[model samples]
Target chain A: MNFSRVIYNKFLSSWMRISITVIILIPFAIGIALLLKSLPIIRSDSIFNLVGSGKWAPSEGKFGFRPYILSSVYVTLFSFLFAAPVSFLSAIYLTQFARGRLIKLVYPVIDILAGIPSVIYGVWGVLVIVPFISGFVAPVFNTSSSGFTILAGGIVLAVMCIPYMLNMLLEVLKTVPTGLKEATLSLGATNWETTKHVVLRNCFSGVVSSFGLGITKAFGETLAVMMVVGNTVHISFNPLQSGYPLPALIANNYGEMLSIPLYDSALMFAALLLMTIILVINLFFRFLMYRAVNQ
Target chain B: MRKRKNIEEKFFKSLSGLTTYSLIGILLFIIAVVFYKGFNALSFEMIFKPPEGGYYYGGEGGVLNAIAGSVYIAFGATLIAVFIGIPAALFINIYLNRMKKVQNLFRYLLDALWGIPSIVYGAFGFTLMLFMGLNASLLAGIITVSILITPIVVRTFDDVLCNIPKGLIEASFALGSTKTETAFKILIKQGFSGFITALLLSFGRGIGDAASVLFTAGYTDLIPRNLDEPAATLPLAIFFQLSSPIPVVRERAYAAATVLTIIILSISLVARYISGRNTFSNIK
Candidate 1:
């Protein structure tokens, strides 16, 4: 009877501990979910009403985020267009062709770049890339000021996202089994042929996911874009045109919101939109990764 | 025909090699450009003195206050996070071992938090603090940064704790030790190095972060004598000085950037060392 009692007590204690942990973690998790949900509802009246109104007046309590969202998508898409191909090519070369001390030297540089903070990138964008764009790209694109244009911002953002995509591609390439590459090569295929046929084919899903992550990161970035993108609320097809991103809009305006439910709600709604975009991208990447791994 | 194939193979191989070198070259160019711009603006006095006429006054003005504020806030946040995050991670690992679905959910939430952009975190911090009526204070900044870093620490520490050989725990239990005692003494001791590594990584991240602090800790030139007062940090000082219209302020910003970069690089190196040492010792 005593043995049975001891066994029962142990089981009860273990179950109690598990329950306590669940109790603590569940509330914190739910709070985050709740915050995400509240974002869209906050912006329904003023911001959403102004969505097709084409007017953004902060003083008059009128603001529309459609231009900001459009700018974000345009700049992020342009950045991905530039960063994706270069990063993909680089990954292919590094994983397939690089050898010995050269590989050692190259990989660490990429790692350090991956770890560098985004704020530093902001400074670099302001001081270096802004001038270069104003001097060269602005003239070609017929923009007056190059400092805060989408071209300058997109270029800097592309530079920032390159390392992210490259790193992801490298990992996926590394995971490609050695035998597959050797099998292709043994059939009289050249190194380029083997890489193009075997390695690239195998890592296609990873490359797609990496590209998605890059686009998401570019879309979500605020500081670098804020520094160079000129934060105007106008929409334009030209890359040299000035614009604001969703995150920049939230960061710049949220403090001055003056207890206005409309403004606050708009900010929250933009945040909700951004979070949803990020969540969708992350889920898509995870699905691709799982498929790749399983195959 | 065989000779031609060999020649073609050699050409493609060299092209691939060139591509790798160029990729690395781009990274080097970025570092080089930053140094080139920053080096011209660096002066010995900038490190020791404050800005005069919107420029660094070498003899008297120093980044001492900013450095002090950064260390204080970072330490404060790390202390709070360690207290909460470490135990929460342990709870997840030991107690919820049977709940795979819940564990997976927590892992996904943490990853989402990690991936959410820093600006969002800054906005969140701004809202949460203003709502709580703290305004822009050091305590507010610390609280925000602590929340920002907690997920990272929890994830790393949880991984370390969970990877500990299970037999050690079984042995302790077999000797009639309570689960709590076994966890606190044996499992924790075994994972001490990894725990320290996680702490240091979080500390480095908190110290390096500027966006989250920008709104939470409004910039004040005066030395922060209390936690209730707003203070400047290295990153914030660099940012404001760079953006300031004054030429002197611009130079000071560059100097500050150089210093900030060095500090971040050193901390990252130390973190790498700690992680490397822990993995090596674990292997042994």
Candidate 2:
């Protein structure tokens, strides 16, 4: 019986280890697959020419990712700036100031918001935000715009990110000890003061980590942003001007992979670039979270 | 100074409250818009029948093709994800319980995987399909979505398993239960509800996702009869129809969106309900 038990434990442990090995290999497999497929473009074009130039003329063999990269950064950053404050405040309200029943009600709403697909958000963006931007926001600035600008994309993205970021922030805020808040209150601190000085201070790392996560999410978003952001291949600094993002570039052109000589490689390269950026962001934030937890 | 502090507090409190209210308002508005437009365009024929001639040109037929495709792909992907993910999560939480470093490493990797955008997955899936000499088909879509959502399933289930009380495991082992017996008989039994919730959550994600399957699942007007055949999905259906110049097509897009939204929300509610009930039943 003892011998059989030993063998059983050994067999189970080995099987579980194999599962871990397979799970661990997945990211690397994806990375290598992307890298090998994109290798042709990487080999044919200088890295600088690929990333630095803004020309994306597929017919001419030029595959400059500058415009797409810049637009992605601009849209993501804008959305993060707009979303972070709103979600932070809302999370505070829900976790600290709201009653139990109100909080309960809000959770489902948040879940619904998060559950809504990117396509629906894109639809709403086209119907409402696009018109609002072109007709009202753009005209106010005396600029004739198509309304498919980084700003519109940013707005839709910000709305999408709110529930996501707010969910994380709520979790972080809840981790702040109740006793810590009570102590501040007992010391005659106003509720807001306690929140600001104690709750926020205590969970600062968590807040930052959540924002990092939100940024990663916003950066990777393709469909919704693709729909609203005018898919113009231009290096535009203006939020009102339309710009193409990296993921949009990949999503738009992968259908025509066979039309051009290096088109597939170019799109694959774009995927590689996006995957690399997201990987770095995730690692950096994961490190932050790990350190915060350990501390 | 005291007056200034009080005013600042009041100002921030009102701002937060306003933001929270607006957030809820936005959710309501989105639902209202989808339903208002969708219910008008939605009909029994739309839901029950496949698209007929000139569907994209505002002809007779519904998105039954896309709806059916989405269900098949999501179901297959979720099945594969659960098959791989549960074991991985169980391994991490149970077998490697004592090895914190290894556990954290696995977690970090999974987080990285979870953070990857679906579009990249689409591109990668496309590449994989090409290499394997496979055209865009239901099988390709299923594989891609499974890869995309496996991390989500694993991570969510890992969180569930991690929260399982340690005493239960200890008692199982103390009763001379072997690791295999303990894992299947004890941990699985303990986290069954959580496993269901995780499945539902990932299934919802798979069904709703448009980006990953964009290239891998070649859209079809008819429901695919086999794994090798192309499949249309609701999100892509909504996307294509919305982009059409015809107003009628755009309205149908909203109908599709409404259907997709309803399905996803129902899944979320079920998962939430299960998880809520789980907490009550869990031993403290």
Candidate 2 colliding pairs, count: 0
DockQ of each: 0.29, 0.61
Model 1, B109-135: lDDT tens digits are 665566666666676777677678897
Report the number of clashing residue pairs per model.
Answer: 11, 0
| Candidate 2 chain A: 10-residue stretch with minimal lDDT | A286-295
Which candidate's lDDT is highest?
2
Fnat value of model 2:
0.69
TM-score, every prediction: 0.84, 0.96
How does each model score on lDDT? 0.72, 0.88
lDDT score at residue B239, model 2, on the 0-100 scale: 94
Highest-DockQ candidate? 2
| Candidate 2 per-residue C-alpha lDDT over A211-255 given as tens digits, one digit per residue, 9 for 90 to 100 | 999999999999999999999866658889997888888888876
Task: Give the interface RMSD values of the models in order.
Answer: 5.2, 2.8
Per-model fnat list = 0.22, 0.69
